[model samples]
Target chain A: MTIVAKFEIPYLRFLDSEGKINKPLPHFAKNSRDLISLYRTMVLTRTFDAKAINLQRTGKLGTYPSSLGQEAISTAIGAAMQPNDVFCPAYREYAAQLQRGVTMAEILAYWSGDERGNQFAANPEDLPIYVPLATQCLHAAGIASAFKLRNQPRVVIVVCGDGATSRGDFYEAINLAGVWQLPIVFVVNNNQWAISVPRTAQTNAATLAQKAIAGGFAGEQVDGNDVIAVKYALDNAIAKARAGSGPSLIEAITYRLCDHTTADDAKRYWDPQTVEQAWQEEPIKRLRQYLIKNKHWDETQEAHLQVECNQQIEQAVTEYMNLPPAKLTDMFDYLYASLPAIYLEQRREVEI
Target chain B: MSEITLVEAVNQALAYEMQADDNVVLLGEDIAKNGGVFRSTVGLLERFGPQRVLDTPLAESMIAGVSIGMAMQGLKPVAEFQFMGFMYAGMEHIISHASRIRNRTRGRLTCPLVFRTPYGAGIHAPEHHSESTEALFAHIPGLRVVIPSSPVRAYGLLLAAIRDPDPVIFLEPTRIYRLVKQTVPDNGQALPLDKCFVLREGSDITLVTWGNMVYETLKAAGQLAEQNIQAEVIDVATIKPLDMQTILASVEKTGRCVIIHEAARTCGVGAEIAAQLAERCLLCLMAPVKRVTGYDTIVPYAKMEKHYLPTAEKIIKAVEDVLSYEG
Candidate 1:
């Protein structure tokens, strides 16, 4: 038989689950300051996740999706992206949003069903949270196409969940990106579950990363629990995109250690044993152990950071709580550039 | 002054806008080298180059979502679905993102994109290729549904659609794309959207229609005029954020209305207009508001299509029934 072609998916891992270096550390690992910053953000994200769950349980907030074991993926994304680059995020990407300068109060307001949360002044041009699974992949491809058209140096990083990779929108987007050689980086968080359905049912593909090959781009995998590995992969992808080399797909393998959302009861379908197993490789603890093993962080520093995270989160919660509710007319004001007669008449009926 | 068919007029509008605005771009399947399946985008890629006129892969949802992204980032992208029947694949993006982005972002980000596709049944086309589903887009809150009947209106309204601050669904009448030619001035002028164009004035009855139905309604009005029963013709250019003021004023004058459209009758745009007129101008209406539209069934294949569309004769009969009604 004549050989036509062959392909191999690259895998990346800098640290083992126990915090020991399994491979040569990437450049980001050599910078203790950057590593410490990533650790701090991951800690802060976890702290926020716990408080958010409490808020939901106490009826103070709406159902919130936690970033439990996947903190490293979002942290690496946020830390590695340039300010000018656009971040297209899925709903579960609260950690990434926070890293990109979105305030905790803003996220809280959004989960509470307030439109004001999407008005991000810090990341003015960034796309707001996408709720419909893989649709943002196309939006990112479009944004990247615009950058290419204008000859801009900026790149777009669009993140989606493992299940989103099964959607036609994801394939269509990556196909177009490949055809146009658009400046985009697609990061799929393969967290092993899509609500009640497991990853095995979503696709029979060997690795989610390999799906990029069908769309004519390079695909690679990374240990999502290892922030250094994610950062390394994301940095290289973004750099390649900005340099106009074309788009790349990075699948960050992780595990969902919590229920899909506050509204879900994973205990109904998930085996408790698997959940217990996933907790062993959780990202926050892995990074913390690494920091402690390197002597860059001690028990005293960890305790201080915890107290600080609590104070900051409490302040944000208080600020969000004290704000006045949005007005009804606010709905009519933004529906169009100018209010038409139909809306005016409707508004008048409501005024009385 | 130049005489051009409606399809040529569409090409003119796209070419003119691409020249006038650096941000205006065209993207669709076979639009670049093939100049589109209908040649509505002929000479665009040659004039604007591949950068401005992109030939995308055969994916409708991506075409729509990408346009939204481009529009958000200060580019005016005009995306084309090969036909309206093929638009259902893109309906998710159109309904979810295109229509709600402006309101969702509180005016911080607006989608200034135009989704163009040819609609209506005629010319012996296949089943899905001939669909008049403008009402679907018109029903969307944040979208402006614009349809043009003649060459002149096609050129003018298309420019306005691309220039609109929000998303607009520009549905072209496939039947009349090359059926007739009119002297359309090449001047880069756009007609006002969200306004009804009164084609022929009469105080007897208002014949409200848009897209290809406008042609039949005009023909029916002429036949009605010969019978000494003058019928007014009003082309509703913009279906959503409908120009009800103009329609209501005409109905108030004529005291009768006969809406015509080649879309499914149930929950169609004609139903909305009829309901609105009944609510606001009930006392002024001399007779019941009537609708001459396509059946509630799926548009039939080529052999059965002509029997499915709304015709001038059908429109005239409805006007006669409303005019002669005692109730």
Candidate 2:
């Protein structure tokens, strides 16, 4: 048996980190509508993140994780996916959820700790928010396995963080996905930090993408701050997955420019210089500058998009805040088709 | 009726359910080609093919987690965890997600799945081979916990669990897999998922138990019969629903009670049964309720297993204690 000493990370990107496309741009759409749409969604998600933090500070919402600087990755992946394909997102995938049809009001309600906000009716292709870390990878693999078994032509993309790669579920999921050659893509958002612990402390490996090589699959590393690069790489990987080739891991090297969640303070851990460096490479600004420089966007259009996004986000927040208070027993109702005796007794006690 | 061992009965149940419903599928480690470690799924691969009888990897969480997704997609999946003790690895999926899917989705989705594994002590197996953890599943709100005492009950309860429109954990007693034989009904017959059965009737004291412990309880009841202490025996086929009416009625009629189980004593099924009796039938009690349970500790390996299990003698001692009490 030949022991492999090393493997290479395969990244296919048309755009560099400086917003320059190395290859000629494809003749898809020059109307700038798509670019404007990406900008609007990113701004909306950012606003949502800020509002969620404010709500938590005022005791109006539960602990919330913000996707502050990772907007380009989520927006680009959402843009490249087909409607029939399924999206299994981690808790920090607010932009992806919004782009894939989850209402802002519903997402806010979920962050507010209401079960009704977890509703997944409109987007049948989207899974509920997976909060248990890397467990969603296994779910995505299962869905992809089912689709393969039934001879269906759909890809299942699962999103996870760098911390999730160290979890056993991540390995089990990818291993199964490889064994069965399922149509799935595992996206690892390497935000560099998992709460107070840094990514370097979590794994000794050089890159999270290389972990996929152990399962006999290739992976790529991309600049997560560039929307163009993210879209190009994801589109190729997703196409390869849908063609029945198997699974691929995409490690997007991004930064968590904000705290891990609203309940945390990054100032307690990271130095101010590191945080400042991350803010300089912010995904939204990089994409916005590219659009303006290419004459695809102007100051008038940017101002118009900002006003529209702000109005939409405010409306969603108002709708969420006006909803009725959640009931405690609502937790007991949907566990099974019929409640067991123990839950019934507990419900009765609560009623009394 | 055909007489068969508990292992054969479980195999027959899977075969019959697979034949009756096209939606029913089985998946687990070595469940297809190897026919399961206990041969509980023998001859299923030839009949159902690879799609229906899948041999999964040795990952427990994926086994249970994938079953939840399959059930959500309108398939009835019966997954085997090989042994009850290994079920702990998949407890997150069982207790948190599978049990809460229906409630979490507000009836929009239902996990019609069944997890089957052998539990209880009596066999001289290695460490982690024998465990009685029905109470853990019983304490969860959305799950149904079933423990059948005999081959016939095993067949009937397995069918009921497969047909039930919810998730159920079917605990099969491995110690008695081939030790006892009973005449089981033919295909399509099923016992109610939430009902209890009265094995014997008497008036002196009520003996409540389930699973393999039911045999020991019956033996103790027989020993009491010779001493003129007529003890009533009730087998709790369904542990979660508890069939409180049957237990409460028996406790009220006898005015004395003894709960038996092979799990740890601290928070076993016996504790829940005794507590329910105290809260519901305290006025009718002539003596305080007694309990016969295994000591609170990890199940020791083969040589000392008998000491760790609650036996007939232990039940007899608890009965004597309750009989001699003046309270």
lDDT of 1 by residue, A1-352 (tens): 9988788999998888888888888877998889999999999998999999999999999989998999999999999899889999987777788988899999999888899889886778888888888999999998998999999999999999999999999999989989899999999999999999999999999999998898888999999999999999999999999999999999999999888999999888898888888888888787778889898999999999999999999999998897698878878888877876766888665553
- Residue A343 C-alpha lDDT in model 1: 64
lDDT tens per residue, model 1, B250-273:
999999999999999999999999
DockQ of each: 0.84, 0.54
Q: Write the per-residue lDDT of candidate 2 for residues B82-164, one digit (tens) a residue.
A: 89989898898888778877776566667899999989888887778888878889888788899888888889899999999
Per-residue error for B263 in candidate 1, Å, reads: 0.7
Worst-scoring 10-residue span by lDDT in model 1 chain A: A343-352
- Kindly report which residue pairs in candidate 2 clash with one another: A334-B102, A334-B103, A335-B103
Q: Please identify model 1 stretches exceeding 4 Å from their true place.
A: none
Docking class of 2: medium
Per model, how much of the real contact set is kept?
0.76, 0.40
Clashes of each: 0, 3
Local distance difference test, per candidate?
0.91, 0.84
Off by over 4 Å in 2: A1-6, A26-31, A341-345, A349-352
Native-referenced Cα lDDT, model 1 = 0.91
